[model samples]
Target: MTVLVSGGSKCGKSRYAEDIISKSGIDKKYYIATMQPFGEEAHLAIERHRKMREGKGFLTLEQYTDIEKAEISLQSAVLIECMGNLCANEMFSDSAVEDPVSKIVSGIKKLSERAGLLVIVTNEVFSDGIEYESGTMEYIKAMGEINSRISAFADVVTECVYGIPVAVKGDV
Candidate 1:
């Protein structure tokens, strides 16, 4: 089964996803993290997230651009933390790859089919206020599109509010 959990920043999307994965009774769990530590704030954020996942006893695979590599490595259940970052990395890659959304969707479909259960975490960018800058607006628009595509493919879609999950597409 494919699950998609979305929420704002620090809204418990990751924790909720972890709970769902644990409750699924899947023995092998992998946390596919797409974050890259660029500076101090990024490093601290990554470390904090790492600590949270580590406390749950989840085996993590940190990848920046090649999600297919991590997808292929999973033997059982997997939780991909945040698709937005993955999409960003794919679009910003050195190689000129065409149709990044298609590529990402294909890879996600493959992972969903191969894994016993896959839970994807993404931010609901459209829920926020409109962006003032053109670049920011464009990025948000792209993220919104990606979120819609992934949510359509997901068997279960959940939205988190103040650390509580409100089921939007499937059973909670």
Candidate 2:
């Protein structure tokens, strides 16, 4: 089963995913965190997230750039926090760096197949409004494409508004 939770920053998408994982009845749980600590701000943010996961007793594996590696290695239920960062890493990486949406879809499919239940967290960037700059517009377009693809694959698609989840797909 695949669950996709999307919302703006600090809207509780990560907490939603974590709650689902904790209640899924899966014995082994692994958190595949994609965000890399870039500086003090990022480091502190990551540490805070780490503490939250630790409170739930989740085993976390920091998979910075490669989702495929983590998917192949996991035998338990996996929660991949924030697809946006993963997409950013792929876009900036030196690899082939072709179409990002296709890469993300393929990665999600692969990971979904390997885990008992795969819960993906991503930001709802499309609802943020139109962008004036060319680069920002392109990024938003890419994120929109990725969001659509992931929603299609997701067994449960949830959108968080003011820390409340409104089910866009599947049961609430």
Candidate 3:
């Protein structure tokens, strides 16, 4: 089973995803962190997440790109977080992904197949209705498509608002 949890930044989607996976009764939990901590802010965010999962028995893997390349077995419950960063990382890398949406979706599909329960956390970026430069716009468009595709593939899709989860696709 795959679950897509999406919302704006700091909306509690990550915490909700943690709760869901912990309750899944899968025993083994893996937190597939995709963010590459580059500076103080990023490092702080990573620390906060680590604190959140401190007591949880999750084996954290920093698979920043090419998630399928990670050697970890996926039978355990897996949570792939913050797809927006992953998309941007792929878009800006030297081997820039021509079709980032397809690549991200493909990677998620491979992980989903092996994972007992796959939880994906992404951002709801389009609701703001703001225009941006071409590069930023391209990234946002790719994220829009990627989020849609993942939602369609997931068994459950949720949008977190003020720390509350509102189901968009399936039962919570």
Q: Write the per-residue lDDT of candidate 1 for residues 85-120, one digit (tens) a residue.
A: 887787776863677777777788888888888999
lDDT score at residue 82, model 3, on the 0-100 scale: 77
TM-score of each: 0.89, 0.91, 0.96
Residue 116 in candidate 3, Cα distance off native in Å? 0.4
Task: Give the TM-score (vs. native) of candidate 3.
Answer: 0.96
Candidate 1: segments with Cα more than 4 A from true spot: 71-75, 132-134
Worst 10 residues of 1 by lDDT: 66-75
TM-score ranking, best first: 3, 2, 1
Compare candidates 1 and 2 on lDDT and give the better one: 2
> Once superposed on the true structure, which residue ranges of model 3 sit more than 4 Å away at CA?
none
> What's the lDDT for residue 13 in model 2?
81
The candidate that wins on TM-score is 3
Per-prediction RMSD in angstroms? 2.0, 1.8, 1.0
lDDT per residue as tens, model 3, 39-146: 999999999999999988999888888877655575789988779889988899787877878988999988899888899999988877889999999998999898
The residue pairs found clashing in candidate 2 are none
Cα displacement (Å) at residue 26, model 3: 1.2
